[model samples]
Target: MLHAYVLYGVAGLMLVVRGIETEQRDSRGGASWNEVITDIGNERWTDYYIRCLHPDVIRPLIRGDLPKRLQDPEFRQRVSASLNLHATPGVYLCQFHQTGHLQPGDSQETADTLEQRRGAGLTLRQWLMVVDDCRLYSDVNNPASRNLAEQIDSAYRTTRATNYASNQRRWQSGTRQQNFAGLEEFLNMMDRRWLNWARAQLGTPNEWILDVPMVRAPAVVGQSKNVTERASHHLALSGSSYVHSLISCIVKFRFAYRFDRSVWQLARVERPDHMNLCEAIFSILASAYTWELGLNQTVSGASHQAGSHALTASALNQIYQQNRDENLRLGNVDKSLMLDEQLVQRIKEIKAFDKIKDQKFAELDEREKRVVEKGRKMDTAFEALMAREMSGLIRLQHRQALEASRAAPA
Candidate 1:
């Protein structure tokens, strides 16, 4: 599982780097794209965003025996303290279609946006407490959660403010971010004698690996291998995979929010930011709950655009070229027909062949036209869908802001 996770991260990092390189080559100011491309290539900042957005590793952390273990008060307190200590400072809400603000420019929309922005951002500790402890989406009229929300909010504001200032000073003093080669670094550290001794003192992995089958594949005789091979081949398609990986990172992390770098820098604490590695992972994973809800349409639209631009979907251009080659091959076959016939019969046969070929060519042309038209219609529908989803997200944000206000202490 660790191996698969690292491989996926590496593959994603490669795509991100390649995509930036591609963008630079094609665009006018490609040369100007430097540090960000390099950082992403090296698995630095981009890894943080990618992990936060997808949280694929969260599956094991939540479902494993850990949650049951967390039910113990002492264990929960330790976990909570670790989370607060290492938690990345600041609230990272979805930007929602890169608008930063909603349409119609209404006063209500403005107020909702301001309300969300004005709060002292939640640290991971505060975020989890508010999200899990208060059960923000549920607990309608529940006084316990409401009171906890107020208490957590008060505590979080104070905690985040103090940390943010310290982080800002650290950033100003040119403190370098620790080179985190993701989870694999821990294994490397463990190999050293002193680190091995430290680990023996620290203890070993405790989380239970459940044997439950998440995806079941019933035994199939002959066809299974062939199908699996075909699927692997499709996954190997370079242009499509790179385009997909890049677009996913962009739409999920990049387009969802546009952070002011200066403001965001203040939120950075020295590494190791959170206490328990697994808990920190889970927190980042769970952080995407709201963003995923709102950005569904935007994701679809971006995927469609990648498919169209990269020729990743149907390879429509390749199909067109293939059709042209087929036409040429047919024409060549027709010329061979003339050699096999007598003079008078050959003339008649050539005319007959010409009519048949023209009919076949006409049919092929019609099919290509239909395919192109279908793609166009799909693109149009995708745009409309995105617009509707964005509007809905705006309303949802407004409603959430209102609900939060009502729940706040008077």
Candidate 2:
């Protein structure tokens, strides 16, 4: 009975592992070894071999020169999903001869095969070596292989830089910045757009930000009186909602400046031509900051006058010290501010602000705690909003693509 039970348990484990493997293969659009080879054919032996050797070895190739058959709308989508699954390390490798990163082995068969195929023979090991080569020597020699290779490299570098800068800017902007979530979403969208724009711009008419206005001016803003129509036109041209949002923000700020003197002055919206999108965004932020301060001051003032409650000097000091400590921990030394000194200075400012505000709430009250809690809630909401906005923007771009197809010349 004991032996039977052990055997059954081992069988069950095998079944489970087999099931998981099957599921993964299905999800990745993977075919049986025999099926993959047959599908590729002997004439395309190099393609089959590279893919069989390691899944990732085919990615750069596919992305660079997607097989004509695979370019079918449905097929391309499925292949893209499959390619994404090869993100794991050691799962794929490039041929040593292809990437020129690793020295070729002494096997005559491998070397001859590689030479015949023009450095296309790849094993699973070679796929990994290729990725390492791409990552390490990406900046090396500019080989004139194909236009696609250059475009992919250029786009990848631009995307990486844009992502880094956008993340850094978002961190600096903090939770207090007006429409922080919207702005973050916009930044992410802009990164994707800029990458696409860069790829399209390369050796083309649509080459830069300034080129967009010059080449596609009518499409940029649209001539429609209807708001939805105008927005749709802009969406089709820009290929992104962030661009639409930017344009909308600029137009709205300009209109607002026409009537509201106070808003105009605070925003510094002097001339229509001078009103850039970044400037408009900063104006909105300034307005939001003013509103927040006013609301906080009112609440603080009421609590002090009523003598209901107040934060203790110790708790206030603790909060200030914590902010300072956080700033220090971020270590902006190259930024010219010693962590400790910056923290101390910020703490001092907060302490001074608290002293002035504490007159109304000398006893430390629920009101002050509510204010702090509100700030935390705002920060959380901002993060969530940004995520939602990004998803929405991607969806909007897809929708625009569909619309443009429907309206295409028959």
Most lDDT-accurate candidate: 1
> What would the TM-scores of all predictions be?
0.17, 0.14
For every model in order, what is the number of clashing pairs? 2, 11
Instruction: Encode model 2's per-residue lDDT on 1-410: one tens digit a residue.
Output: 22422343222222332344355446655334223223222222121122121222223222233344244667445333322212211111101112112244547765553343332222222222323332222222324322323433333332222322232211223232331333343333333433333445456532322221110011111111222222212321211222233333233232222111111111123432343332222232222222211211111122322322233435434544543443345452232211233334434654665685676576467677888899999999999999999999999999999999999999
Please give the CA lDDT of all the candidate structures: 0.32, 0.31
For model 1, residues 1-410, the per-residue Cα lDDT tens digits are: 33444544423333543574556545634322443244334332223334334333343342344445456677555444323323343221121111234445468866565444321122222222222331221232455534543443333232222222232211123221221121122223213312233234333331111111101101000111111212112211121121222212222232233211111101222233222332333243223321321211112223312211111112322332443343354353242211122222323443565576699899999999999999999999999999999999999999999999999999
What candidate 1 gets wrong by more than 4 Å, as runs, is 1-341
Where does candidate 2 have its weakest 10-residue lDDT segment?
A: 213-222
